[model samples]
Target: MENEVNTAGRPGSFRFIHAADLHIDSPLRGLSRYAGAPVERLRNATRRALENLVDLALAERVQFVLLAGDLYDRDWPDFHTGLFFREQMVRLGRADIAVFIVQGNHDAQGTITRELPLPAHVKVFSSRSAETVHLAALGVAIHGRSFPQREVPEDFVPQYPDALPGQFNIGMLHTSLTGAAGHDTYAPTDIATLKTRGYDYWALGHVHARAVECESPRVVFPGNLQGRHANETGPKGCELVTQSGGQMEARFVPLDVVRWHQLTVALDGVESLAQATQTISVALAEAVVGAGDRLHALRVHLTGRTPLHTTEAQQPGTLEAAVHAAAQDVAGAELWIEQVHLQLASPIDRARLAQGDDAVAELLRLVDELAADPAALVAWSSKACGDVLHKLPAEAKAETDWSDLQALRELLADAEATLLARLGGAV
Candidate 1:
């Protein structure tokens, strides 16, 4: 770790874009299988998002761009992915905007076999060790290292060189940074360690949610440029950073052409499907307005205690269709419902039932016990679905992991919801 500084060139103020997890040419998971889904648009979403990123860089006239990691999604499916990326790089190059990148876990050196010649302006950091790129013209220094393998269990921060003195220093890394939920811990380190490196800004990736760990040093995760699934909902984009008078300021800029949203609509007093549809329509309209000109892919969760619970549970497909129809009718911008979840509460007094020494109470207690225990839930589900499992084709059976705790948890929740809905009507 050398503490070398190259203080050259006149720099009063400068601006650059910091982006990560481009996942270029990657398709949004599980959307294509749904009916009425804009498969073509979704399939091209990453490409379009990359194009938008380039457009923003060109339009903003940023001196350079920092891509933290995960530029490709699990290696190249084909050469077209690499070519598309090269084209975007060329676009940036023509505008004289250099792109500095460090490959994350998803696109580690060994993972991506195919390669295309990127524009001269693009500089991918070496996977062997931490390397620094000095932009003499901008009086800035960027230090980064690509992941050599998919899983980086060890902290590599110590290996990074000390920040250059008298220059605006930036450190680019792809890490989970002390274990973020829903993300694997990769290149794990602490914010304190990053701050001690004396870098002006830390451009981080791997975690798909935007966050600013520290404002003074400006450690930031721009998040993914696009939301690739339901879990990754909300506005996805990059950070536009400006350096003036030795102070760095960052602003989030949305680059996703199509946005994914998860909306919860309460139906507390709703009694009929018509009212539900109307409520959903209003919610969709609001979402459309909020989304601006971007197309929206939404998953609507219908919640709250309602008399329509039984009807919704029994005819979910119909309800979902109606919700989709409502979206189509009221949405000023283009919208599609990825799914409609019915989480309507039963009218039955569950607390009172739990207190009683009756068969229903016993059953409820057993269900609660099973839901808490993953092993019990898995055993129960396997026994319950034994006949269905036997009938499943070999390929399907191979693909299904029957012991998955997450899957069992979801199954139990759905079953509990349905059972409560039916029991409420009978009671």
Candidate 2:
């Protein structure tokens, strides 16, 4: 058994797995099509992670499993996705582990018309309104409501039924909870409002980063079962919750088969590319220690002021190749560089350029201004791309969103760096 607290005199004492944002069969985004990339392995990552969750539950022999939401992606691409989920459900059913699920924005009712019959062990909450499922033998009551549509703009807290008297209450909610960065505000509610519901634990979803919002009532987000992109870095998994003696204990158990990491390596005073490569190898070695045997999809950010800045910026592809070589050399575990970023500072002194009010200084000032203002950067990109973007193929246009402020900023930064390198005599 994973853990069990003695509750000899207590009425409610049980353990359950609380997990959310499974995103089963969801494709990993932003994968490179370059040679030697682990595209196939990444494609099947979600399924592997889901299997791990089931294995953990069986090994621990939990009474029940609480899947807060997002069991499926936005919609099923085909019936295979549904079949895979059903197969897993059958596995859990055979073990007598009941699964309580609530539909989040991604898997809201009507999102996917294709459906396969799930095992009897799974109890999906209603999308029309909040409802409760009482586990009579365990003295547990689970309250939840699924998203009727893709977006839930109103608060549904008041609709949840009151907790059953003398029962362990759990609220399975797929909410953004007031607000969370990089996630749409769905089924929004505040921590204060959740606490008012009198539930012993709130299993939250929608936020892909695991967070423990409260200890008393134990409001928690177990994060996504797997990290689909670089932005969703670090350990991703579910929460193993144990309730005994009126106290709730939640522990994060990482179930992701592959981990995404964003590592930063400082290159201060580095004079040559060889030294820089050595530095990256050392960082990769350290990262490998933490990754254990899991596959690592790393996005390395090379930062700091260095004399090799011009070379790195000018030949980013070459530098990336070197980093990839180093990763291959030192990686004790499977590691792949999703991308390598050069955020190196220019060796040229801005103050010295400003002292001479020349064209170079004015150009630098203009670039700085555009970089600072996202709107200006977007306008500049629109003008620069003008006729060329329109002439491009429909597929190319669809792939690139020039209107995105962040994308425009990155493009402008790269252009500025290239221009600065030429003017500063680095070329």
Candidate 3:
């Protein structure tokens, strides 16, 4: 295959790809449990992402590819996962592009147990200690270390060898870099330690968000090759780095076949259940456009004051069905609503309504009282809905979190809204 890229600017210009957290064949977010989920496609998204990475290496004619960590999700249930990875490596091998990899926590627990032979062009770093691989032909030195086991509480940087003179040194590590939100502390080290480590560029992994921690020496986390769940939203890909005359430049490219998104659709001016669904449809279309052409797995949170909150409460699963229909309505748009979170509010002012003296008003006042006192709310719920609660096990209480004050308050509000809907327009 013939591919062309501009090597404009310097004499010894060369390109390389820096990627991490492939998590190949990862079972994403347990989508299989959901009836309407695109389970097969999402489960295969990680493998597709890896293929895209290989294709990019061939297209860009990159000298080498760096996979910082987590190449596999867990120990293979079968040999297909390993076979798939080996095929991709062979593809890169045929293109004369070498690959460098280090085992992250997942890999340490997973693929290490079911080892498979990769192409000669690929090198996986040793787990016992840090090792440096030298490519004298390109004057490049890559230093890395794989995790011996799943947990690495200590620093791996201090054990790494110093940079060799007259070479473009790159440090590959699977670390949280001190600590990061939504990530466990593994191979933790601060930026200060990295800055003094003497590497020209640092490629990090483990954290599933794209970040450029430093610019002067170019410290980066390419993010996961593909998003595994709704929590991991937005474009997921790798860093394309080009070395021109001794200066390095990097850019991110979107490679994920399926993208995950969390969208908030306001229902303030919505008139009916149909209109509410239409508004969410418009929002989904716009979100998909902004995300580019790919399958969008969305978790939409409906919020704001609307009359449809009552309608949605009365007709359970209607909103979900409406959203599903909307996602399919837009031709050529790949959309799937992963979930519909309802945070909708009634249009009426409950405080003002409660001031009146009527059955509805008395009900509102009672709701307000229960909401203010958690203990009273629980006791009331037990008295009101004891038949249903008693039929189920005590463990079921955790599911709805009846003990949480805020959860009970929300439940009371939703119940109040449903009652108001049946009473006639909140007047």
Arranged by lDDT, best first: 3, 2, 1
lDDT string for model 3 (77-163, tens) is 888999999999999999899999999999983336777788899999999999999988887889999998989999999889998
What C-alpha lDDT values do all the predictions have?
Answer: 0.82, 0.83, 0.84
Write one digit per residue (lDDT tens) for candidate 2, span 1-427. 1233322232577779999998988875545445677888888989999999999999988889999889888789889988988888888999999999999888988787788877888999999999999998988989999989897999999889997888888899999998999998998899889988888778899999988887657788989999988898989888887766766656789999889999999988887888888988999889768656889989999888887767755665766877898897784688888878877776668667745677777776887788888788888988987898989767667778887887677677677677766765632
Which parts of model 2 are misplaced by more than 4 Å? 1-10, 29-32, 245-247, 313-316, 357-396, 404-413, 416-427
The best candidate by lDDT is 3
Whole-model alpha-carbon lDDT for candidate 1: 0.82
Cα misplacement distance, residue 352 of candidate 3 (Å)? 1.2
lDDT of 1 by residue, 1-427 (tens): 1111222223557889999999987755555447888888887888899899999999999999999999988778788889988988999999889999999999999899988888789999999999999887678889999999998998888899998877788899999999898999999999889878888788999989988877657778888999887788878888887776655556788888888888999988888878888998998888767667887989898888876766655655666776887886884588878878766676667677867797677767877899888788988998988999899777667767988887776666567666765665443
**Better model by TM-score: candidate 1 vs candidate 2:** 2
Q: What is residue 371's positional error in candidate 1, in angstroms? A: 5.6
Clashes of 2: 0
Question: Using Cα atoms with residue i matched to residue i, what is each candidate's TM-score against the true structure?
Answer: 0.86, 0.89, 0.88
